[model samples]
Target chain A: MDWQAIRLSLWLATLTTVSLLVLGLPLAYWLATSRRRWKFLVEAVVAMPLVLPPTVLGFYLLMAMGPRSPFGRAWESLFGRTLPFSFEGLLLASVLYSLPFMIQPLAAAFAAVDRGLVEASWCLGESRLRTFLRVIAPLSWAGILTGVVLSFAHTLGEFGVVLMVGGNLPGRTRTVSIAIYDQVQAMDYAPAARTAALLLGVSFLVLTFTYALRRRQRKPWTLI
Target chain B: MDAHLTPSPQLLADAERRYRGGPTVEARFDIPEPGFSVTVLFGPSGSGKTTALRLLAGLERADRGSIRFGGATWSDAARGLHCPPQARNLGFLPQAYSLFPHLSVSANLGYGLASLSARERRARVDELLALLDLRDLEARHPGELSGGQQQRVALGRALARKPALLLLDEPLSALDRPSQVRLRKELRSLLRTLDIPTVLVTHDRAEALQLGDRLVVMDQGRVCQCGDIQQVFDRPTDPAVATILGVETVVRGRIESIVGGMATLSVGSARIFAADPGGLGWEVFICIRGEDVAVERGSTPGSGSTARNRLPARITALNPEGSLVRLSLDCGFPLESLVTRQACADLGLSEGDGVCAVLKAAAVHLIPHD
Candidate 1:
């Protein structure tokens, strides 16, 4: 098995999950509460990843992060490096691929909170930020946890976007999925099976834990 | 405006709002004296009672008007001045689900005490728990407690802030009848001890009567009457106010004569005397509540009774409403009387039975025909 590819995949997944969480919290909250006229437009854009093919999304991202694009030129100027086929490129691709996984659950959770509870918090002299932290955060922990775990797992299994953007750069961007694909094409069935088994086991464990936690939180009496 | 005339140090409000698909509310009210008193905003559903409370609490903005709470301008649309709910420093207990479901009862009580020291916060929480009889449930979350317990916790949390004003919007409407009655009494006593101005909005007449020190009758987004509880209950400003107060009988009468302080009025061949004789030869409405109309057996009016207005009537219908019996009488004009079930049984009262409906002249309220 290619341990380097496994390490790269884990790092990319962790970084993508963290960045998605940071970006998704406010976006989800705004979607849940804002009454702006164009809110649905933003919501649709966020959910585009769920419906569009991963390769299609990665194709646009690849062009956007290339040297000819303004963003790509700015990135090279500021960071002193190109974005295409680098670790940062793969990380950005993974974040976009897993954006919906991080936002949908969070938006639903926030929207499900009793509005009366929010108003009551405000009436008790709590600011909106404090109410979100002290009341909304605790109530929506389950959705947040679901979003985090789903994002991590989805990013780990990414293939089409990583290949479209990273271009099989060996140790730099060759994640576990690309390694398995390369091994399979080279007629190396043993290594491919081992790597595939590892991914399956990790995904199973994460999904099992999330499902169990959700079940316990939903029907607390079942825990007893 | 006189330079020496200072604004009164009371809670005054004049608010107007027009919703796109809902009612247009134009409410104007002033509490010239606001201290340690419960002012009930009573009306039917869709009457804008809750809207008025929300405007006072800054939960909803008014289109045009100003609110001055004890000399501080909370909201003034003309000047574009408004205070958010957080800065208003007021407690609001909604109809239900006011307690934070995730917080323990004690933590819920301690939430608004961010300015207090840790020790003081704990002491304050403990004091509220004891005062609200919630000491045993301090560790329980809102979901773990009963509805009545949750309501008590919500009340305790609201009072924990020692807010400048307390706004309660049907706080007891979600409880069962027995729990509602029990909690209302407890709330009345608890509110009496606190020296805060309270505005409670309720659609229940019984709750309003039992809890209100001052009453404001609202109808169609307007305050129809505002006065002391008994005075408003006794003499509503108009027919709409009387109907909202659950005044059972409202019969039109023509003033016949005014001898001394008593005024004799004729109602469809029946004579009734009222305590007020403002103007003779004018039509007026004689309003009386079901509970104030006493019933006695036989057609002969109580011989030695002091009640000046006694009419012989025939019982048309009898309704058993829990502990009390409602008797529909036809004393020339329609009238209703509410009596205890025991009194109903002792008199052997039934439909088509003849009885004397004794209404004291003082109980007879007169509202001039509009």
Candidate 2:
């Protein structure tokens, strides 16, 4: 029943979801439309985290966030501290770990969009940026919704990455999954059950709501 | 390159593209790949006709070709220059009638006019609505409209910008017969008035023949022939061109006689004369327009008058050609002539009707098939 850990976990997951979307959308769009030879390479790298253990990604991220590494040193110089064991650190780790979940569905959805529609918009003299905002984004809402919800839920359940990078610091880095472990280790079964139930209920409700909204927006031709 | 060699305004206005290499498909035209006042890429489907249209639109990059449009190098693969579709300033009505379903008719029309003033945009949209006969449906959403209506809206949207070049990729393919005819007529008049170089891709030969000022016959990703409609129709470059142009029927017979610019050739018991002569005793493919053959109820052949190429034939089949009827007749040879339903009704025509098929010998063109 540690409130700070629960609050921190929620914050980390939310921040990760938001940042992932911001970064993933453009990347997905590029990957979806690109004919470059390196596009496959880029896709393969994005998909690496899906197959690789979360701890492996977390280990690299941990090293990358430490003050000894170049990126970590630059960050330290900017912020006056190491990023590990911080909420921002957890967000970055979760974003990377959950990237494919957010991007794949979105990219698939965006790709599924009738290319004729895109070409039509271009022929209408709408800029690519405007077309994406007005046509691609609105039409691909279902896939995007699925991607966002999946990323958020996956980030919420994220364990190995947060444990390795965020370092289970109560009131700062300790998320609900880590908090549940701590409760059970201390033989506090009741609070662990409560937290586990909370995670399950919240994730289920969010996913259900997102799916319902998608169904509502579904066109008759989209039934298949 | 000399400074004088750089294209002038008139040169740009009459841009021509001659692409070679790559998967050899025959399109040999000197046309600006972009910014044409009316450059129609006309041929049957799978004829590389669509590719030619796309090249002009700057949608598909050519493998090895130079495209100059309105004094700009749209694409020159050998020179490693390719202008993207955005820079082409083209109005393309792609197949599937890619109307913005989210936007209403007016909004869809106004989308391309963003570069213009508000008043200009409004005026343009209004003019298009009137021109397309869509003034009454401005408020309707694309999804709510019929396929024909959506097509018109798409055409309106494309025309709203008044692009330097217009590319129509089988825009009328999805419409009903009536709608197709209506739009075809409207499109011809509209294109003429706008004077924007247009490239129309279609599989419908009649549509191409009617709409294209100069038809470019393409096959297997190449242009087989390119010329004015009559030139191409009268004398196709090859048998393939003849086939694509739907002029494949040719009668091989020695010239028995020639009279008044028409040569009579004896094929089997029936005599077929040239509507337009090739040469005396020269083997020829007698090209006859399907509409030129008229059916009669009686076996008595019509006396040769101004209308020539008369034959005593049996009605083999009747095929519908929109409002008209096309009769496939056994004129002692496998040949078909297209005529209207009103004509058939007036003649009381039917299957197995023994009739003398009246045709003008002048309509029977002689082209070298081999």
Candidate 3:
């Protein structure tokens, strides 16, 4: 069943989800609350992954992180490694590829918070940051959960971005999706079927848990 | 409502803010004098009533003007200075009592005491819990409480910081009719005990009359009149103010003569007397509240009813307004009288019936109009 590939996928998805959490939350908050006139442009850029083909995104990501590129050279000088084919590179690619999955739900949740609560907090001498942490963050638990689940699930199932950014390498960048493809190509149909079944079961369980959580909400959060 | 403390509006403001695709709301609050009492920002919907309160709270920025609260200059457009609500140190109850959904009653009350020590905060929260009469529901969340309970919790939370002034926007509008009326009395007495200068926003005239010591009448995004509550409600300055004040009957009248401080005005085919507004223009708008007009039989001109201007008229319409019945009459011109259903039954009044509309000479207010 390519258990090594499965483990690697899990690790990549975990790191990618964490990285997106650190990066996406503030960005999502800003996107949700900012009143800037040109904020739509930033929103569009963040949402690009939703519409752009994975292969197209991967192509640009590879170019931006190539050995000859400025970012690639800077990374080599600091981390002493190229960014195109390592685990770190795959993690970064996954984070970018699943950006919208994390951000859209988070932004929607933040925006959906009752504005009256925010104003009340301010009136009570609480700063904006305190209000966000105390009032907004707690109410937005559902969105955060949805973003985490979607990002992790999407990164785990990614095939095209992984193929373009992280070339197949055993114990390094060969994620479960790549392993499944490799098994099918090598005529290892039984193992491919076993791996595919495991993925289907996991996906089904994750979706069921998510829907149950949403349905049980006393106050319904956004469907997304 | 009380002389509990030396409270002052201590606030002065002349601000203007232009809304997108709407008229500019110009709030001119000049309560430069001292002593605490309730001041209501009274107006109809879209009349900038809430904006006026928000201007004082530092929530709504003025496009051109300044606000001085206490001794500090809160906002000045020319100087490019504006204070945030957090620094304003004011308790603000928004139209909706938005108690934090996730927090319990105690936590909601303690939200503003972040700077206080843990023990002090707890004490303050407890004080509020008792003051607002929510000790039993301290552990409950806002959703677990009823409408009135949630309102008290919200009020407790706002007062946790002991703000200098309280600004409430339609504090009772969110509740059901019964709770709203009940809370209306409770809130008034509560504010009286607290003794802080308050600026409340409400479109309901009954609320204004019941809660406010002073009233600021607003219309079309401007202050039409500001004075004592009873005075403003009884004698609005102009037709616009009179209409916004809900002065039920306003008819065009010409001053025919003035004698002994009483002015005789002629309407379509009837004559009436009002306290002279001497030289307040010959063209006048006569404003009379329905409650001030009493209904009697047409034959009872000198019956014990002492309202001076008892004009003989025919009933036009009868509409029920809560416990009272409003009788529309064609007494020379249109007029309205609010009487009990029992009074209607006693008089056996109905549409097309002749009746005497009794109005006091002082009840008729004259506003000069072009």
Candidate 4:
């Protein structure tokens, strides 16, 4: 029973999901609605995580957050702590690694909104921000929730990025997956099985929720 | 030109728009004294009618030219000026009613009044609910309402801001045919009571005729004609306008001779006289509305002073259209008459019957074919 690791992983996942929601909303909306000629270029960059190997992402992140890097020095100066091998670094890595999970669903949902409604909103003298809050946000809550759940699940089960950014430290940086690996390495099969089983159950339940929300939202009547 | 001497038109637009690599739509028209007028942009599908409406609504940018409304420049491509739809001071009803599915009817109606206090918003929404007769559906989401109800909510939402102009794109197109037929008159009456200058875009000929006071007929991305609805219908500028207006009978006629001001044109084996709308040379296309054509039993043919051409013809087809049956006739040239079903029954007319097809010479309109 690695209570500390489990708590750390849950906290990190929660923070990462919240941060992604705040950051990903505008980014996904821009990707969905922008008519700029370079829109596809931005879309490609956002989707890079979906195709890039997790290990390769972890390696670059590790270099970027290293002591010699500008980001690492800025972070150390601000927070008075080095970024690598810390929980904050692990949180940053999880957000980067799990970005597509949050953005893809939100962007798809935004693009699915009827363009006529947006135009009608403007015709009624509503500004762009008011229209989004009153019309678009209400229509897209299901997709937003799905994105939140997927990003949370994705951050929870991460292994390579967490290991590269936050090395083994039981309470501060070590996560449940790392705890399971440690248990297995020490030949403690019983505890490792318990932890792995819990993680698997949680992941399955999260996915079930996401699919259920999506299935209900896909009914045409619910939109038009 | 002193600015005070000539107060500019309420709306003066001469603009062109191109979508991707598709056809470029060009339009030029002005509305003076538009307090209670309905100017319709009418054409067949792909005739750039909706594009013209969108340009006026500021939902689209013109590739070139300008749009001036109420002394303000809304769009001028040469000056790199484009006003957004939010600033256009217009209401628009897109083809799909596009009511917000998640908001209740009252909330959707009040969606545009964010600048108002909550009390004022509620009052306005309540007023619209009564105006559109949507009081019962106020609490229902759009998904829960019928198509007609959804349309009213969408209209109410657009009217919430009291826009200077109303733009509707195929306002009744989202409904089934029966609903559309039933609502056409109702919608026209409603627009009249709204007391707003409006520009409507529709491809349906009946919808165009019933709803508009002024008509701007477009074809293949150009404004072919613009005038009073009846005038344009009676005197379309060209063959393309004739076709778009759904003139029930259009036939090529070569001039046999000119007597006084009447040109007797030989169409097939039948000769019809039309007032010489001269300078059409010897070739012209004759356009006649089905409603203008009259038919009766051939045996009781009376010498009537009104109708000039009374040809004894055989019925070719009878297609039932709503309250009327369209009688397609073979009077040496194909002709069509719209008669009530009761008349159709009383005359005992069917697929093959002999009847007198009567036409007033004034009902015949001529336009140059070339």
Better of 1 and 2 by lDDT: 1
lDDT for position A216 in model 1: 66
Please give the lDDT score at residue B139 for candidate 2: 92
Alpha-carbon runs more than 4 Å astray in model 1: A218-224, B1-9, B248-370
True contacts kept of each: 0.88, 0.69, 0.88, 0.90
| Candidate 1 CAPRI level | medium
Q: List the residue pairs that clash in candidate 1.
A: none
| Stretches of model 4 off by over 4 angstroms after superposition | A212-224, B2-4, B248-357, B360-370
lDDT of 1 by residue, B1-370 (tens): 7636965848888888779898877657777676688889999998999889989988888889999898789999999888999988888898875787767899889988877999999999999999888899889878899888888888888888888888899989999987876677678777878878889999987678667778899998888998787678655678699678887776668888878889888987789899973532376667788998999999775578888988999999999988999899999888889999999999999999999999899998775532
Off by over 4 Å in 2: A218-224, B1-28, B31-38, B117-120, B248-370
Interface RMSD of 3: 2.4
Top model number, DockQ: 1
lDDT of 4 by residue, B1-370 (tens): 6887977889999999986778999767878765778898998888888889889988888889999998899999999999999898888888888887777899889987878999999999999999999998899888899888888888888899998888888888888887876676677778787787889888876667666778899888999999887678656777578667888776667888888888888998999878885555576667788999889887365864677788889998998989999888999888889999999999788888988898888898876532
Q: Chain B alone: TM-score in each candidate?
A: 0.70, 0.64, 0.69, 0.70
Please give the TM-score that candidate 3 achieves against the real structure.
Answer: 0.79
Q: Candidate 3 on A89-197: residue-level lDDT in tens?
A: 9998999999999999999999999998998988898888888888787789889889999999999999999999999999999999999999999999999999999
Q: lDDT ranking from best to worst? A: 1, 3, 4, 2
lDDT of 1 at A175: 93
